[model samples]
Target: MAHAFDGKVAAITGAASGIGLATTEALIAAGARVVLVDRDSKALDAVCARLGANAIPLVIDLLDPASCNTLLDGILSKAGQLDIFHANAGTYIGGDLSETTPETIDRMLNLNVNAVMKNVYTVMPHMIERGTGDIIVTSSVAGHSAIPWEPVYSASKWAMTCFVQTMRRQLNKKGIRVGSVSPGPVISALLADWPEENLRKAKESGSLIEPKEVADGIMFMLSRPRNVTIRDMVILPSNFDI
Candidate 1:
């Protein structure tokens, strides 16, 4: 099938690893110019090298607006226009509700939730001016519902999910599309702290999903016909209950 991403521009967050990295590869393969933003400088450099000239690496601390501005400027300098913004960066933290510290809440919210909302608010104006653009935000299955140990993560994802839903209608008249994707347990070192036995059990159970699966889903949506849009898609492993 013809790839719809040819000559497009994409901005991705938390892009140095996992789903973000996978999505970068997918976009590049589809012939898109991608701006990869993340705090991980080493990994970001490696990804850019692997992707050659099609990708740009920006070491950004999403908590800092200055960093984001540098990213926007870099993209404009390189691509001249922003076509798709993939807000796919985040971290995972696990703790019980009562055990969750304020620091943890703030950190996760700042990186996972705050970065997403800020990116949308910052990027959409640019899209609005263009008259045709798309935003793909990554939420977790955890965000759609809740897990016993992940209260704040759930709240943050839910907030992002709701914001996208609300913005879709507002942005529809401008011919911009807003879509959200939620993935179930994805493999990452982010899961390292979990007890070894339980992690092994979960892996044995085949509940975790691969980064490529989520990335392909993103590419599929981007390649859809101009008038087609998916409000949101939840991707849990077939064996998983979510």
Candidate 2:
């Protein structure tokens, strides 16, 4: 019962928790050696220990633009080569635009949009040289449709959606596949920014999906045949609404 990703090398950002953590676990279970990238060293170490040898913990603060290059370099230096990459590191900023401070806005955009673009750019040459790889970015339903509550977060995701689409066309011809996983509300730390009332309502209504569900979609995208690319997967709990 061999899996498609068996023995593949994958590097996932924000790999200590939430969607990223879930995806790391899934990849490990599928027999891929995963590099866990996160700023939380303690949590990263804990995860590495929990998952055993297949999980390689790499502590990094991706907010620094230079770290994007460092991340790829470190992975190559340690793991030898990278077969898959998931730009799953991001933050959430809900509430009205006016309520967000300049610093908050900058942080959200840097992590959600800028870092993702830079990460993909930094990894492209390597994947291109190898002429085969898979890149998946974690987007959100808000990316597909503007959500009034979190304007900044929504804008960042929309930008990611565009980036993934354009990068796919740019890289596909070189044997690299690019795609995105856009999920609705999920149980994760990102929801901490949401209004408590809204969060409670979603939970009560069973509208919030679990992080593992989103990870499952990512697994599906990665498992697709080399000749086929799952361009974008918008996974939402059946009862969840925009």
Q: Pick the candidate with the highest TM-score.
A: 2
- Alpha carbon lDDT of each predicted model: 0.83, 0.91
Worst 10 residues of 1 by lDDT: 68-77
lDDT tens string, model 1, 1-242? Answer: 33667888998988888888899888888888889988889988998998999889878888776786566666787778899999987877777778767888888888787778778888888889889998999988887787877778888888888988998989988979899999988887567756688678778999889999999888878778879988898999877875
Deviating ranges (above 4 Å) for candidate 1? 1-3
Report the backbone clash tally of model 2.
0
Q: Which candidate has the highest lDDT of all?
A: 2
* lDDT, candidate 2, at 116: 89
TM-score between model 1 and native: 0.94
lDDT of 2 at 38: 94
For all predicted structures, in order, the TM-scores are 0.94, 0.98
